[model samples]
Target: MSVADIKKHLYKAIEEIDDEAFLQAVYTIISSKMGPGATYELSADQLQILEDRREKYLKGEGKSYTWDEVKDRIRKKDGL
Candidate 1:
């Protein structure tokens, strides 16, 4: 199905919904993710962790892996 078709179907389904609470929940989730003014605020601890990681990366102390290597690790961990 195309993106346009899925959006039309969703619109029609949402139009048929009568429960205000369920609609509000759906609206909250969609607005939080895609609304015009939507922005995520990270906590101080999260910011500090990111800064530490950046410092390590700049100092060549952080390890990095290729996408295929990461996928292989995940597959091995999952016994796939």
Candidate 2:
């Protein structure tokens, strides 16, 4: 599917999910886009990290975080 198609389907799916799942899915996508940087645009270090992570992921050596982990991290950073 095209990127647009995938995004559309993702949006549709999230709209039907419970609040927690939706937040988690959104966080996962946003985090992946963030990589090792503060901006959506990748920095050199972030680009290298992404490339290495992709390679590790393809080889089943990558890691992942749960939705709760991300939510809590953000909350703490913002003093929520």
Candidate 3:
């Protein structure tokens, strides 16, 4: 039902597994973006840095571009 519940279920299931195929299946689930959410809390300094990044980004001073323009520029710069 909840993420924690799913995680407990997953761990229990994984602990019972012996097959390579089963392990791969669990690996696929774990690596998926929609699967488990990362469990971490930032330090105060890290949070401040993330907030500073947001402030900088909102100022349009990060890297201005449309998708293709940015891609092409990067390609040219790298002589790709």
Question: For each candidate, what is the lDDT?
Answer: 0.92, 0.86, 0.83
Name the runs in model 3 displaced over 4 angstroms. Answer: 34-80
Task: Return the lDDT, model 2, position 47.
Answer: 95
Q: Per-residue lDDT of 1-80 in model 2, one digit per residue for the tens?
A: 99999989988987887899768878888888876765457689999989999999889889777999999999999999
lDDT of 1 at 24: 93
Candidate 1, superposed: residue stretches over 4 Å from native: 1-30, 33-38
Give the best candidate by TM-score.
1
Q: Per-residue lDDT for 1-80 in model 3, tens only?
A: 99999989988988988999979876776678555556356899999988888888899767557999999999999999
Highest lDDT among the candidates is held by which one?
1
Residue 39 lDDT, candidate 1, scale 0-100 = 53
| Clashing pairs in model 1, backbone N/Cα/C closer than 3 A | none
Expressed as tens digits, the lDDT of each residue in 28-63 for candidate 1 is 888887966575678999999999999999999999
Steric clash pairs (candidate 2)? none
> In model 2, which runs have C-alpha deviations exceeding 4 angstroms?
19-22, 35-80
Residue 44 displacement (Å), model 1: 0.9
Candidates in order, TM-scores: namely 0.52, 0.34, 0.35
RMSD of 2: 15.2
